[model samples]
Target: MNPQIPDGLRELLALAAGAGQAPWRTLLRPGDWLLLLCCAALVAASYPLLWRGGVADRAIVKRDGRLVTELALNVARKYEVTGAIGTTVIEVQPGRARVLSDPGPRQYCVQQGWLSRANAVAICAPNHVTLQLAGRGGAHADYDTINY
Candidate 1:
């Protein structure tokens, strides 16, 4: 049997092999370091928000123009669904009820789930619906206060 080789295959192979021998610093530029730092800072800033429940409030769920259920949570659970008719389940921790609904395809709303604290939301895409938790209508005057 005869073996066929492409014209530039030898040069390409040599280049690839040489790459592994180069100093590691040659592969990382200043921009790469900056990007790594920025990502680290972003993750650091988000840790508290993601792990420590920021607030607490009542979460109301509605489906097809009717209220289905309500819950309270320390944080929202993220989920997704897609179909003609779909069901959304909301499980609240520390003594809360689960809200379920039938939503059509493009379950964007299901992705929004429940955010027990600030910067959290539940959304249903196909139905163009959302479920969220917020503070009571009145009686609050603290910037860092969280309602349990």
Candidate 2:
């Protein structure tokens, strides 16, 4: 007895065989070039806001279950948190933060590192602490805070 093949499978194989042809070159039209130029200009105009550290985003800090402070990020680095008696320095990095203090058994906050994106957060579940970033329009828009 001979094996039979499905018609759908045969059609797929034929399509794959036909797809092995050489790639084709594309020519950008004048309209396409104009669109590209416009996009580039817009990106260039927003570069300062997009790249400047801490100036475009807000930081929310919580300690001992209370809102301590909120500030704008001016640079990216390890943030050390102090002032909590009997506690160690809390280091914050991009996407994670860790506490060096052995306040308790869990050490969960030390496990979470720095957070980079706007509105993202890290929490010390053991200490009931949290650090969060502010999203667009959620941050204070005081003119004094803006860096020229």
Candidate 3:
């Protein structure tokens, strides 16, 4: 004997199997426009961060958890700092600073390239040297501290 299925359920299943997906416009509600606008606003709000990155005007060098030296930007100069292990060299320009040399085996800090924007940092764990940038508003550190 075969089991009997309800006629209404059978028709509904057949209709569902034959129908394709509905269009997105058909599924969208009027309130969804508010959500779309909010998303657009959020995207638009992030645009300024790109231009605000390079406004830093100070260079701070720290060694062995102590403030070694703090230099104001806008003038071109080079500064040398001694760490717990070895020596480090730092150079600053109008709006940027970078590590010229860091005594280390890996030379990772020396290879960090130019740091011309706010919050840029370079650290040499082998030599215990750090270079960081800041703005008048506050100091920005991507990595707070590293100990090796």
lDDT: worst 10-residue window of model 3: 139-148
Kindly report which residue pairs in candidate 1 clash with one another.
76-114, 108-123, 108-125, 109-123, 109-124, 109-125, 112-122, 112-123, 113-122
Candidate 1 C-alpha lDDT tens digits along 43-124: 9998875544445466655555456555555454523322235545556654222334535455554444434454344556
Q: TM per model?
A: 0.35, 0.40, 0.59
Residues 1-148, candidate 3: write the lDDT tens digits: 5686888899789777976766669777878988989999999999976666457788888887688888888899999988767778898888878889877889888888777666677887788888888765465423222311
Cα-based RMSD of the predictions, in order?
A: 13.6, 10.3, 6.3
lDDT on C-alpha atoms for all candidate structures: 0.52, 0.56, 0.78
Superior by TM-score: candidate 2 or candidate 3:
3
Off by over 4 Å in 1: 1-54, 74-84, 95-107, 110-114, 118-120, 127-129, 137-148
Over 4 Å off, model 2: 1-56, 76-85, 92-102, 139-148
lDDT value, residue 101 of candidate 3: 83
- How many clashes in each structure? 9, 12, 0
Model 2 local distance difference test score = 0.56
